[model samples]
Target chain A: MTTTAHNPAVESHGHEHGHAEHHGPRGILNWLTSTDHKVIGLSYTITSVLMLVIGGALAEVIRGQLANPNGHLVTMAQYNELFTMHGSIMIYLFAGPFAFGALANIIVPIQIGAPDMAFPRLNALSYWLYLSGAITMLLGFFVTGGAANFGWVGYAPLSDAVYAPGAGADLWIGGLLLTGFSAIFTGVNICATVFYLRAPGLTLFRMPIFTWNLLVVSILILLAFPILTAGLVMLYADRHLGTHIYSVAGGGVPVLWQHIFWFWGHPEVYILALPFFGMVTEIIPVFSRKPVFGYKGMVFATLTIAALSLGVWAHHMFTTGVVLLPFFSIMSLLIAVPTGIKLFNWIGSMWRGQIWFSTAMLFAIGFVVTFLIGGLTGIYLASPPLDFFTHDTYFVVAHFHSVVMALVLGGMAGLYYWGPKITGYMLNERIGKVQFWLAFIGTQVFTIPQYIVGLNGMPRRMAVYPNDPEWQTLNTWSSVGAIMIGISTLLFVVNIVASWKKHPAGDNPWDGHTLEWFTTSPPPHHNFFRLPQIRSERPTWDHNHPEAKALAHGKEDH
Target chain B: MRIESKILLWLGIFFGLMCAVYWTWSLENAGGVMMFFAMGLCFLPGLYYFWWSRRMGYRPEDDPNATQETGAGYIDAFPGSSIFPFTLGSGAFFVVLSMVFGSWLLIPGLGLVIWAALGGIAEGRRGGDK
Candidate 1:
């Protein structure tokens, strides 16, 4: 328990303590042990990039096998491991850390005008723990029994030691347990920071939409992940100690795992998507040169999405033969309202403004287009009968990939747009546009036909499809598209590295309105030279000029 | 800054020590429910010191103004060292001792004691710094 520390510039009658800035170590040695929020953020970004490449390579190998029906490039064991690692690495290591964790570490403090994350050293600890978990799980690949093949879900008796009989399952559970702890610790840190660390005059209502979205996300992680920890611990007990948490013969219920996993898993979708919502909110306002449409409404909608996310886990469990469909259906439909609100907000934010088709904006627009199709199809999958048809089919695969691709692509857009500010250098826009188009076209070429293939009754996770004439053309096209997508991803890496040092970017390259833009590009050890006065959500807007301020604030009375 | 924080600090230490003892006792007894309960107990003193510190008028550890962007207190609370010391050390200590000593309850029981002692000592020191 500590006193609420007030910024030096703000002279409240509150008591203040003189803090000695502790500089522990120096150089790369310092970075290795460094607790700086920015350094930790860089660590997250670098780790995520490496994981993305690893996961993408796995995807390529799997797609190569499935390129043609019954293509014998890999054994079933190899395919199962590939898909499992692909899903786990992409979701946990790539999307989770890179998108929210990295961005939040870098930007959230800046957005709120705080100097750094509330817990910088703990921030470093969370990243290390996450890396450890990810590495341990990947190491299972080289083990004697191979990796866990019960899918990333690591479902019951199939994952049981008796049925699976391997050290792989133990490793899987252990890795996830460690990862779950990291997520929770990071959530705790973020929540505390957001609650207690806002600069003077920066009220909750005045916080940026991205910060608001992350606030809801942090809460969701806190509420959802602890249960996942509990569930993983139980599963580990069953695997190693002969406990019967999921064993029916031992009086344990197998369906219990599904309930616990999806409870966390469903919110995990929002955990992934909500930050994209935040980035979209940020991008839309900047490109349009307009205040975000319905800022308060967007905040409310984000919170609603996080809240309703908890009750809809059963939607994924519908085909499991034991789900409360009525409850799940109601919950699922309820989620649509908030999601639809965000959709309208994005569209409304872009309405009638001078739309700049920057590579960043292209991905934002791409997200909206792809997410719509994905959302509509998601509604179909929410239904019990429809899900039964789409269950295990390429249709389900198509719908999910669409949603996830839109989400991750939006994240990529945010990353590139903000990377300059974070690094104090501009990306190679020429190569950026190339990479964007390649990814945009590659996604469509690769995934759009997945819906058709799924409808034609192609089961997912199969290394080889039987010689069904209907699935051939689309499957071949999808595989080719995947290769293109992989190439584009590589170009994105090249573009980032090539321009890392040479390109120059100013503090406000996009002329953004948020508080983050008020500081130096890449900022300093302490984010701001002197903490600026915060009146509204957009502090930089006020500091930039009084005339621009009047334009934004003018609508207050109107 | 105040006498109350010092008292609360020692109070935190006392409860922390009690928690450590209770946890170790539970581990040596090999009671699964008790072991779980002990883990929960470990969170109490850290929380109490945190609460008491705030009440006693110390700015929060994470408050940028209080920490001065140097992150001194953050590391003290949650150290990045491998938690396997708690997990594996305790798990192994219990399993091995039970096997060698032919005492089914001895290893897990002592394992719990070790976990409680270590966790309590670390957390207690974090609060004692101020």
Candidate 2:
């Protein structure tokens, strides 16, 4: 409520000489008590990288187990735990939080012509809570009975205390609850920051594509996560307090949990993808060296995707025996319209413009191709008949990995593209292009065979398969491709570490139009000196060419 | 210097006693039925209490601020920022009542209705302050 004018005193922290002395805090105390969003973002990114390795290792375990029929690499219980942890880590901890919690924290405030987040302390709290929740979840593995093996969904009856008795399930419920709390709190902070902290002339329409997508995504999180938390509470009560929320013995429907979870979970899918949409929007314009084509259309498409995402939760439940077919199918098909509109805008943004084929742009363009195929496969899954055939098969895995993994990969691309701007150092571009090509090829080689094997009735999560000669070649191919992804990712790490000391890109290397490019690369504690008045969606355009600005607004020399 | 802590202690003890009695009576067999009946009876009065609380000199400062960069100052920039005084309070009362009575859906249903009504009022009165 304390209103203060824009003050440069609040914004100045970096000395020109100090930039060379490591801008972020160093050592243990620096990490424990740090409030800088960049430091927190780095923490999240590191954790996500570690989890990706863990998730990929689990995939190797899965591949080894499925290498031959009657393979004894791990017990069924252990296999369940492995896959559950893999899915949980990949979707929730790795991809979901990185795209939003890390990137949005580091980027949105700067892009929106603000200093740091409106609530920097609360931002720190969100990260700490998330870390606590993640630790608790990992502790579930070391506990007496081992981690929750009922998959990340923790579907009822399987998750019921009667069937899956122990502290394992309880720990899972508790950890997920804490994680959900972190997500909700982060959402609230982001939403409030975007809404209340915009610079004077910056209206909602004029927001950068990334910030716009974040605003939409954060609102989705706020609306969706609370219901998920409520459902988790109900699930916890059933496990610990002997409640009948989802217990069949107590007349509670198991499918109710699915309904509530997917209600959050489906929007969760968009929450994962929309920021990448923003990334693409931002990158296309910069690399193209033209104004983003159809900026209003892009914004509308984002909102449309968010709105449509909410109604399509039941698509995940199509094979649950009692799920309504026509309703979910219709909703699923309806989502494609908005998604198609977004694709059109992306393609339109790049058309007939001078294109820069940087690693970031390569990955962005790769996303379109991979995501397109993923979307086409999704349409097949939308139908009840096709889903019946494809449920729990490698084909579904292929579809999800194509779209969702592309999102993660695209987010990484954005990081490399913007990290220089954010940190005031250039990343080794040579190594980055290598990382991009390897990831692209690895993704195709791994996923395409899975699609074929899945079509041939190869079920997922099976530790072993009969020496069905058909699946052998494909599985081998997938394994090899996984190794490639692993290697490429390692090279990416090497590139980062090598460049950390030497490579430096002064502020605004990309000559970008967004507000983030206004300040010094790797800005201060309080972000900007003076947040410029935003009259159009592209304020940089307005500033650079007064004639164009006058012409666009229909104001002549008079 | 430490006088405030003693006062907080006394107030905590008083609330603890009231809560103990309420919980014990609600969970016990014979007393629980009576408690359930009493709770059902209290719903109307509880709603009226909330209505009265709205008319009190309640400020937006009473609610937790959504953002933290304001450096732990609990007040947000908006006026009339709370629906908590009505919904959270009413929710607690209903939850306790329903728990005692064995009605699973009562509290959540009532909470939803109250929230809807509040939303209607807010929407109807939009921009009046501005």
Best by lDDT: 1
Residues A462-530, model 1: lDDT tens digits: 888778776888888898889988998899889978887896788888878898887778886556555
Q: What CAPRI grade goes to candidate 1?
A: incorrect
Instruction: Give each model a TM-score.
Output: 0.81, 0.77
Query: Residues A404-507, candidate 2, lDDT per residue (tens digit)?
Result: 76886788678877888777898888998898888888988878999999999989877777687778888878877777777888888898888995866776
Q: Model 1 segments beyond 4 Å from truth?
A: A1-24, A550-558, B1-130
- The stretch of ten residues in a row with the least summed lDDT in candidate 2 chain A is A1-10
Error of 2 at A73 (Å): 3.2
Candidate 1 versus the native: TM-score?
Answer: 0.81
Per-model C-alpha lDDT, please? 0.71, 0.68
Per-residue error at A125 for model 2, in Å?
A: 1.0
